[model samples]
Target: MMMRIIYPILGMVMAFTSVLHAQSARITALPLQKELKLPASFETAVEKIQYDLLENENGESRIEVVDENCLHIQFIFSTDKAVKQDDWQVSVTPAFSPSFHWAPHLTPTDRHIIDQHVFRSPALIMADGRQVITLIPDLDIMKKGTPVRWYLDLDAEGNRLVLGMSNSRVDDHVLFVREPGAEYPAGEVEIGFYLMVNRDEPSLKNPFRRPLEFLWKRWGHGLYQDGNPVDADLERYVEHTYNWAFNSWAENVWQEFELNGNKVGAPVFIVNYTQSPNYPGEVNEREFRSVWNQAWFSSLRSAGGLYRYAKRTGNTDLMEKALLTKELALSFPQVEGFFYGLIGTEMHEVEIDGKKYNRSKGWDTHYWGNSNRNPYTWNAAESPFHILDMSWTALLMLRWYDELEKDERLLRYAEQYAGSLLGIQSESGFFPGWLDLHTLQPMAHLNESPETSMSATFLLKLYELTGKQEYKEVGLKAIDAIIRDVIPSGRWEDFETYWSCSRYGSDYLVGKKVARNDMYKQNNFSMFWTAEALLESYRLTGDRRYLEWGQRTLDEMLMTQASWQPPYMYVNVLGGFGVLNADGEWNDSRQSLFSELILQYGKLLDSDEYNERGWAALKASFVMMYSPLNPVTKAQWEKVYPFFGKEDYGFMMENYGHGGRTNAEGEGMGEFTIYDWGNGAAAEAYNRILDKFGKIK
Candidate 1:
């Protein structure tokens, strides 16, 4: 009898162990459910048994459940007074779907899913003529292992409210509302139940906790993973180049200047020429000089500050630099509450001192000047394009101000700049690509130019902050105008011609003579701008077409690089250049490769392969430019008479040929470029990438 009993117990233990092993092997699995819902009014007499309720001594309410197939909820409220009819709102969030794995810092065993909406009320006019908003979920159709809860917030006076809900299978939800020193007619509000569910479960932690890890799971991320280490050599080169450009010998110069309080007339000025445009053998010496001087002292100070910030404390330094830059930039007199681009010259100059300079002398006279002879310049004041550039700079300042939290002046200036730009809007709900600086009239002839796209992007950001419908409308209209005029008309070939014409309103400029269109088949910058615009619009509107176009353009750009070698990748300390063909061949003597790599890196947060390729390209170009010794110096020197007298292109280019050796032997000893645009772009790219991929919490 004892042997038989022992045998039965042993069999039972073996069976239990087998069951545990089976469950462990499938730990990531979740129950599949068709749907779940909670009616807007919980008035429906439906029966579901998946809940428990508990009442505390303090009159607080708690709801609990432990089912994989259903969510349970309960409500408790004070019965001291009659409830107000329409003073409360209900909200329910369904479990997030786990289509992808959790990010690095998150636990894979925890719930992870996308939040889905169930119900929202239409604009409801209250009896008192006030608008009340509300939403609900249908609980019966929720997915398996989903968490459901209800929220109640009083729009009017409420002394105290306490509510809590949790599920053994999911995370907890809590709501607390308190209004002190307020009295209202004694009333009680009926608490109702609302349920919501998606095909997946909601995550217990914040979604953005692991951006890079999540990014790696996306289709693009997988491609990047496969290609990354294979391009390790290139990555090393890029990282080395970036280090030299932003953190090496050049950085030492900046640090020395900073140590001296950025005093004027330092030896650093010798390296300043690199910040200006370099055009070889050009007869127009004056033009070249003008371009070089355009890198004003103030701009250099700001750029240097930014570089320091990037290399040091990312946030603290950035905040300080942003404030300083804004203060300095705004100190310049405004033509019409806008800073001028250049000094002394009416052409390309927005303003000088307090006087309104002649707009006719600029690139487009009528847009920015008082002259009617050149309608192109007439919209200078309302040039959304120019305004957009300022806005971008201001936005950067604003972001830093938000980080610092102590400087009110920086925040105030940023808002002032943004508001001034917004004031230029026309009656037709359109922001002209160009504006008449004198009259503030829309330069309608410029068409829905690239400014339309860029402005839309900025407006969207503004809308998020301000919650103003006008901003949203303006942003949507700009996007719509572009889609209607530019894309549908097949004017992709006319990449440079401004499409907003007075007669045609905003239409495609199919046959306009713009050098951007004539020289290159596609303006690479425009494509990037448009891509960002479309993606941002899609984020706001959930319009698939915007996403589709963005993805298509992005894919095209990425795939094109597979075939061709980038030309003169060492030009312009910054990454990127103008005009890339479908095959990835680029033109333009001056290439901003640093900007290109950084820009592409920003986009790579969403794509794995693109990110990998971007890193590879960035590494290759960076190493080639900043390596200690110029490997090609001897090769190029052999071509010159008396090889000992050969020019060191790398050293000369990096140091602006100032205080640098010109012979191959002195290659690694040259001074680094100081206060150059390349440094700024590199700093910006590094910070941006670090923000996206760094492990900091």
Candidate 2:
């Protein structure tokens, strides 16, 4: 690279960014070409070069070569900077890009690949295998965590590419793109990102495996004596997330809510179970449960989190919370016949489409999963019916009845819930994501994500409890259906990187081979469950193919883990989100589950290969902790007080690596978030691992 310099604090230069085998150098860029156009309010005098445009003219766009070595391009969108809403798009190509093979949506059947604008992280993958990844790190899907998103697409062709981001203007979430046909008034919006082009050996493939392994060895997190690969461990992280989230869970337990002018005390619940501290100038409070019905999994997620943690650790206090959470889940309204679920809360009045709808006034909005962010007008017909919630809720109840205290108060509900799941199974083993809330029948559109695998694992567990042959049959059928979609070779290979399961299969319902819109793409939830199904199938059915499939998928996942060592270990790859976004963003939702599954399979299969890789992956969860290295700034800090904890000592962050630069709102950079999703999963994974293996030293 250029002349090496020591970090002001570290006191020494550590050849941190050097590429051993690759001939890449990020030298101090040469003097900019005189013809290069810059942003309106741009300023940079020190080592780094920066440009800014508070407001922009219509049709105004600029691209400049900032670094000749990496062929880095500066992408800018000209618009009014005062507009606080996110509505802008930016895309720039490296010097040698040709066409794009945008990844295929992860549908189980009739998967279609395309050459269109992609999400979260945008990158230019050269035909020769070189990849130039564009990063808008601050615009992560999670408002608090680093953001990574998929654009609906402004341009489908390779001539242009646009990335997606939420709160681009309001919170300085940079990578920005608007919904298809959704227009913004001519206004101010500042969105920018960095493009890194290098032959750093795209990590997941067979030939590209060296770089990821190399990164961990050289750059892995080490606050201890030596920065060994082992130091990027999962044991400590499990404790961090589990303990913190448990406290929050306990604190938010509302004993009652005012319903019909009466204080009800039956269903104990958490208010801030899935919210981040609101940023400054943001009026949204994170603790309102408005459209939670769309993402019913939130309740099950919290309960399951507490339950798993309590089960793993035998914590009496947590056990009480777990039981209470589940008891509240039992109180959730369910539709007859097929057994649909609800948000376990009331819906207040909301206005939409000139009509008032059931909703509650709150700040809850959608980021990921098919949930109505707008509680006022959230229509069930327009949203996804999350079956995974039903599955987990049943599992929670069953465990309460069978494994834990054997409480029959919840057992009747558990039996009915599990029975409903069985009744809804398609004779052909198909389960659509969008289903009729009442009949448990396929809704208008039959989904393609084929959540057969996800449901299969839950059913298998029920079969063990009741020894029901029908449950076993349904579970086996689901697994078989999932195995049918396994693309044997090529890019998808052993793992479902490009195509597998999804959170929504509504695209298939519309006869669209690709997703037109979404809750989340390339979901980690689907990936983890699929792998778990494979392993569980092996254990229950003694199918060696299932075992091999699980091993192969985990092996590929280990290779694809995108992580950074040292000063940047927080973004290190943790087999967390296998979204396989070429731009290298880490979405840690359910990541710990994937890691935990890998660990379980490793131990049972007696495969040290899986065991070692799994721990490294799980330990990487701890590596996700927030530190002083994040981009969240002082002005943003003023926006969130009681919410933001010790700046240096923080919780797990997900969907990161996209925020290499952009800051919070008008501030310099945004801070990392403390997501309950990451925390809950971390706690559960931690407890289970500790219960079985004891604490790692």
TM-score of each: 0.44, 0.56
What TM-score would candidate 1 get against the native?
Answer: 0.44
Question: For residues 1-697, could you state the per-residue lDDT of candidate 1 as single tens digits?
Answer: 0000000011111222111011121221121111122332221212221211111101222233212212223333334443222112222211221211110010111121111110111010001111111112222222121222222221111111112122111121110122122221333212323222212211112111122122223222343345421223332333343344333433222222121243221112123222222312211112211111121122423343353454455556444444444444444345555544322213333344554422214212212211121234433233233444454445444444444344565455555655666687654434554454556555545344544566677667667666778767877777776666554322333123222111111133223422211211233344455566777788888888776656544432332221112112212111122232211112111122322433443463465444454554343233223233334432432233122221222222221111111223432222333233333333344444444444111
RMSD of each: 24.5, 13.5
Model 2 / residue 433 / CA error / Å:
1.9
Q: What C-alpha lDDT, on a 0 to 100 scale, does residue 693 get in candidate 2?
A: 65
Candidate 1, residue 181: Cα displacement in angstroms equals 93
- In order, what lDDT does every prediction score? 0.32, 0.41
Runs off by more than 4 Å, candidate 2: 1-283, 290-317, 337-370, 373-384, 399-403, 408-412, 486-521, 555-560, 563-587, 605-609, 622-654, 657-676
lDDT of 2 by residue, 521-636 (tens): 33334545667777877888887877766655554344344333212223334333435322224444445556667668667868654555566555545444543322232223
